[model samples]
Target: MATTDPLGIAEARSQLGTLVARAVHGHQPTTIRRSTTERAVLISEDDYEELLRARRELEAGHVAEAIAAHDRGERETVTYDDRAALYADLGLPTPGERS
Candidate 1:
């Protein structure tokens, strides 16, 4: 089946092996669409690890930039008295936010 076609969660359940094969061997990620707005992709572990590594690198770059900006007096410092205050400042309670 074409990966371009959406796979409903129920159908994905029965054909998991095929989906895994497509991802692991073909490097083709399959989207298991659950709803109009929600879905998950089945990708190879290698792909997932690469994505994670890329994200870490990006985050580190951002942090370095933030530090450089701070050193240049281009950033302001604010003190928060509590977790709620800090979270509020950062627009906390983000979707699916974890502790």
Candidate 2:
């Protein structure tokens, strides 16, 4: 989901007050760029905090669902006698082994 066009650093710097007002009062987020690279975003404090809270809630819900699934025996369990063989099968490094 892309927002409005990004503002260059120079333009943003010159219009900091206006940009802040737009983000806060107009509920519009502005992307700030350095040269051609996107650097940061300007959004209301309330909106930022709300986004953070929503992310945490979503993560917590995922964790709870995983726990419930485990409790219900909905997950598969694999036990490998040779840990190195298991890692090789999965194309991953065994414990204490460097990639």
Candidate 3:
């Protein structure tokens, strides 16, 4: 199981790799906090890459196109079962699923 914690700067620096490993194994998100500020996240490489791709697409305005497609019914509505189908179409993994 994944373990998560909010850590101070020193703790984060020391535990970064282990926290990242936990995230990769589908453990709960590890948040590094400094004072009242949230510092960083420990997440899988795949999750990081997915975040990058999504950010890139949003920057390029592809997000608007996807929204438009959904509005126009070109993409099927995201019903419960269709969630995976939608992710599959977008070449993304089901983010919360781990076994």
Best candidate according to lDDT: 1
Q: lDDT of all predictions, in order shown?
A: 0.77, 0.75, 0.67
lDDT of 2 by residue, 1-99 (tens): 225678888899999999899889987888888867547889999998998787667656765775687689985555778978766745555656644
Candidate 3 regions exceeding 4 Å error are: 1-5, 13-17, 62-99
- Count of clashes, each model: 0, 0, 1
Tens digits of per-residue lDDT for model 3, 1-99 = 223456777886887777666778764567777778646666778887887787666544754676788899898765556777866656555557531
- Per-candidate TM equals 0.74, 0.69, 0.46
Best candidate according to TM-score: 1
Clashing pairs in 1: none
CA deviation > 4 Å runs, candidate 2? 1-3, 76-99
Worst 10 residues of 2 by lDDT: 90-99
What C-alpha lDDT, on a 0 to 100 scale, does residue 70 get in candidate 2?
A: 69
